[model samples]
Target: MNKNNLIYIFIICFTLISCGKNRIKLISENSNLILPKDFKILQNETQSTGIADFEINIMLQFDENNFQKIIHQVDSLILVDPNWKSSNNEYYYENFTNQSEPSNIKIYKHNKTLKFVFNHI
Candidate 1:
């Protein structure tokens, strides 16, 4: 291959690898979880204990609008009453009974941030 062709291939590989390292796949696949695209992801972690058991934790810096949107989407389904930790923060837990995809989700909100924990077993 010519020098130019090799340089182009190297650049493409580097770009894909760099982007993959930072990409969060669950955010796109999770239909039940809705988060604004503008927020900065502070943390994203996933653990798999078995073939069909996994847990995902994500924390983001969001705005008031995003926070309200999440609350509204899950309002009617929150299984556990929200526990207010402080004037500016609270937590919500929701459990799904669908046998095909039994799972639980926890949401916590502080002034301008939200943390989501999702588990499927």
Candidate 2:
């Protein structure tokens, strides 16, 4: 093959491998989860939400339907790759707490489509 052809082949192969080399696939397929009610993710778990402590209701259970396993699995992967580096995909987890909710909620968001929701309790 010509030198130019060889160079092009190498570049294409390199791009395909490099494209996914750093990516952390949190899930084979993305699943989205929505927070119940008007509740939104709290940036800080410690911050007071201005709601009555007892009034908060945030009890969540992890199940196959909710796909909470992906979040937990990613948590373990983060230890291996502390950066959890990804080229196209995003992995995010946040501690959520509200004034009325007695339980703590952990929200795991992967890219735009994959989301896992579960309570800390």
Candidate 3:
């Protein structure tokens, strides 16, 4: 193909691949989650009482369905902890559910942390 044709094709392919809807769909399907408006992510490292030497932090907004599902599956979830002290951990959900307004939820671990801001509206 000519140089111009090749450039046009590349642009078209890039545009198609960069479509926002596909990204949104992938995130939603993979996490069974829906993010709130103006959400953001932050990362950090820290020590924990578990198996891992250090934890990775992931901060974002919360989706109610995903949050509930995660709470339910916490026991079965495989958390990456460097300390390896405990295999099972319990989370307090009543505080979350009883809130009159949605609140930010922070999950900490030896290897990872998740921060989720919940919006009631």
Candidate 4:
């Protein structure tokens, strides 16, 4: 192949690879909140109209320990029941205001997947 063809292939490959899922660390000042090993950002969007708004949705596949850890941390931060536990792939959902910011946080978990959505307007 020619030099120009190789350049085109490289550009295409780079674009494709960059489009893959983004990873992030779930950070918080709350000491009880343990960071998961891997969390993939499924969707991240921002818009500016009459008002500015943004949303981040991340998902993680976890085991029992992770589920309990998150549950306890969220409970302490949001004043919910920390004793709540999951079994038989039950679904859990909660929406609460962000204590440290002007945003809303929503957590949904089912089976082994946990999803967190944060929205600001």
Best by lDDT: 1
lDDT tens string, model 1, 16-79? 6665444345443443455666777787776786998877676777678877876666563344
Model 1, 63: alpha-carbon shift in Å?
Answer: 2.2
How well does each candidate superpose onto the true structure, as a TM-score?
Answer: 0.48, 0.23, 0.25, 0.41
> Which pairs of residues have clashing backbones in candidate 2?
56-100, 56-101
lDDT of 3 by residue, 3-116 (tens): 999999999988766653343343333333344454334532233535533222335433555545555454343243221122243232112342433333334443233453
Error of 2 at 3 (Å): 4.2
Clashes of each: 0, 2, 12, 0
User: What are the RMSDs of all candidates, in order?
Assistant: 6.2, 17.6, 14.8, 6.5
Q: Candidate 4's residue-wise lDDT over 1-121, tens digit each? A: 9999999999998865554323223223212245665544454433333355655555556577776777666666545544233344443343343542232233455545555444554
Candidate 4 or 2, higher lDDT: 4
Model 2 TM: 0.23
Q: How does residue 64 of candidate 3 score in lDDT? A: 58
Which stretches of model 2 miss by more than 4 angstroms?
1-3, 25-68, 71-121
Angstrom error at residue 71, model 1: 3.7
Which of the predicted structures, 3 or 4, would earn the higher lDDT when compared with the native?
4
Candidate 4 TM-score over all chains jointly? 0.41
